[model samples]
Target: MTIRDRTAIVGVGTSRFSKAPTDTPMRLAAQAFKSALADGGVGRDEVDGLVINIGWPLGVDYDRFAEALGLRIRFADQSWTHGRFVGPTLQHAAMAVATGLARCVACVCGVSFIQERGLLGGPGDFEGTREEGGTHEENPVYGLTAPAAGAALSAQRYFALYGATSAELGAVPIAFRKHAALNPAAIMRSPLTLEDHQASRFVVEPLHLFDCCLVSDGAAVVLVTSAERARDGARTPVFIAGMQGMRAGPDEFLFATPGLGIGQQREFRYTPTEEQLSVYRMAGVTQKDVDALYTYDAFSPLVWFVLERFGFCGLGEAAAWTQKGRIELHGELPMNTSGGLLSEAHVSGWNSIAEIVRQLRGECGERQVRGARVMQWATAWGDSTIFHS
Candidate 1:
């Protein structure tokens, strides 16, 4: 009767992090899909369901991808959320299998964001709309074009309220980049310091260039099957444990609203803390039980917010936690051991799932955290948040 204990990730795969050349989105998807199949020790014919994120620049059609991959799929669909879609996709796949709608599900996403012909460039040009319209465009015009801007504003507010410094924020990117230095698959592997982070160009005030995640061209796919059938597959099975998503408000402007006097916004939630706490409680695990952490680091401040939200530290105490080296490898809680999107290439947060699988399988090379039994991965897009364990 418990959904958390029933689903397992049997296979995980990803393309090398780099720029997409002449390859089309479908081809990129095929490569990732094949890699996942090979990793899972499952054949393409065994795949009964397919799910894809429709947020990338190349615009993936579920039917087109299934046909091109030669998969006879019984269930196929596309996700709407941006980077936060992966967890939901996995949830859907698990339900499909658990309900006998499909036996094996392949979830995939391909990004051409780093290419010259990418979605960041324009719309219809890509799968999603480029121009921010309706309530969505409200904040972007106020200079919140990218996610970092909104997060930076939050960072500013956190600092203003807690007396935290930018140096504390710098520690996250510095640590992640250092970890990436050891990860061969990472794109930004150079050693980083608080000085380096402070010196980096300002993407948005309070957020340096290094605080932002890279927009890279790549694709990643994972295969999900029944937990009972997982042991027969290629790799160790990482159980779903639990998954949840919460939307506090619509559009990006909600978080960016400046407080109007003492108690103007009494019910407004400024961060993803409540949603994250709910997921952790639902999963029946504590932050102390987690061996590793992979939070969406599209902006550096997010690390702090996640740390507080997930009960790693008290509210307004994330800066102290980072300053004490609690989040570094060999520390109490190692975070972003795969370099995360901050140091590793960003594939719309799919890489977070791949990294979690790698840690669970004990396949991560130099950046691996030893004896990692449980992991926490989170994603945030606009006002929506998704967490998986």
Candidate 2:
């Protein structure tokens, strides 16, 4: 039986985001998990499975975390994706429930990098290391160190073809920060101007400091149960309608190949736009049905790339759409309603997932959108992509 319609998210919770935390990662995760359980009207004893997106500088292990929580888990495993683990984790939890392996599954993500180091230096330092034995080190060494650098390459190519400028890229972070200003949990909620984005120092050429996301410490958790049981619990259930993941090839192969960039790429190119379309197809939905969007914004350029990839607009037209305030809270599509990674504290994009849940539940106090039925969340890791609805 298809798991697409079998599971629903009944509980979602998150700790306040911050660049530096006075609390530990485990404590943050525990708080979020407890909040989720309370939101779902379930007890910790009812959680049959525990899933964590593990990998951080805090030296916290999954086994240790489970032990600390005192959960007698039947299924316990950690996700390996750097920042793109949220969607797949939810999908895996949904599958577990659909297949009778679990009744209630809890997925948690925690980050304390900012508490360890400031914005310029933290968690991302060990991004591409090999644990046992591996040899895929070329692309990462050549300045594709983090998601921001890799996305900058795509941004440069996008500008070349679409005639978009760095200023257009500036608008994404600016818009997100504006929304974040209303979120008390956000770290950089102050008003930001295009001049601020253009004036920020460059982390990578064409990708300014403001264009990149903040390194933060926080935790978020979600509870998934069978769709049949979701409405029996707290709040309205948001069904897990669809999900998909795709990988093209090594980063160099997709980036260096001729006719692979934005407008220059061949029809149905191996770009973000095509990847998003493939996800929409898998979800059995259309762009018109997507009332809200939470595209990964580790970097500002990713916003445009994902918009084009999901067929929201033609290649290179994302900048125009964004500039026209079409993505603002009152625009054609309200995006990043919870401030997003750019302005809100970045908990490795886990906060983005929580924001999507809030939008679906109509719980967003200031940045809430009306009639938000369908929402899309996308994340790109290395050269792989994952999407959820």
Worst 10 residues of 1 by lDDT: 255-264
Give the alpha carbon lDDT tens digit for every residue of 69-126 in model 2.
Answer: 9988887767763555666666778778888898988888877866654322223545
lDDT of each: 0.71, 0.70
State TM-scores per candidate: 0.87, 0.87
lDDT of candidate 1 over 292-377, digit per residue (tens): 77777777877876666556776677888897667788788888887888888787777878888888788877777888888877
Off by over 4 Å in 1: 19-22, 116-118, 121-138, 250-276, 380-389
Give candidates' CA RMSD values in order. Answer: 3.8, 4.0
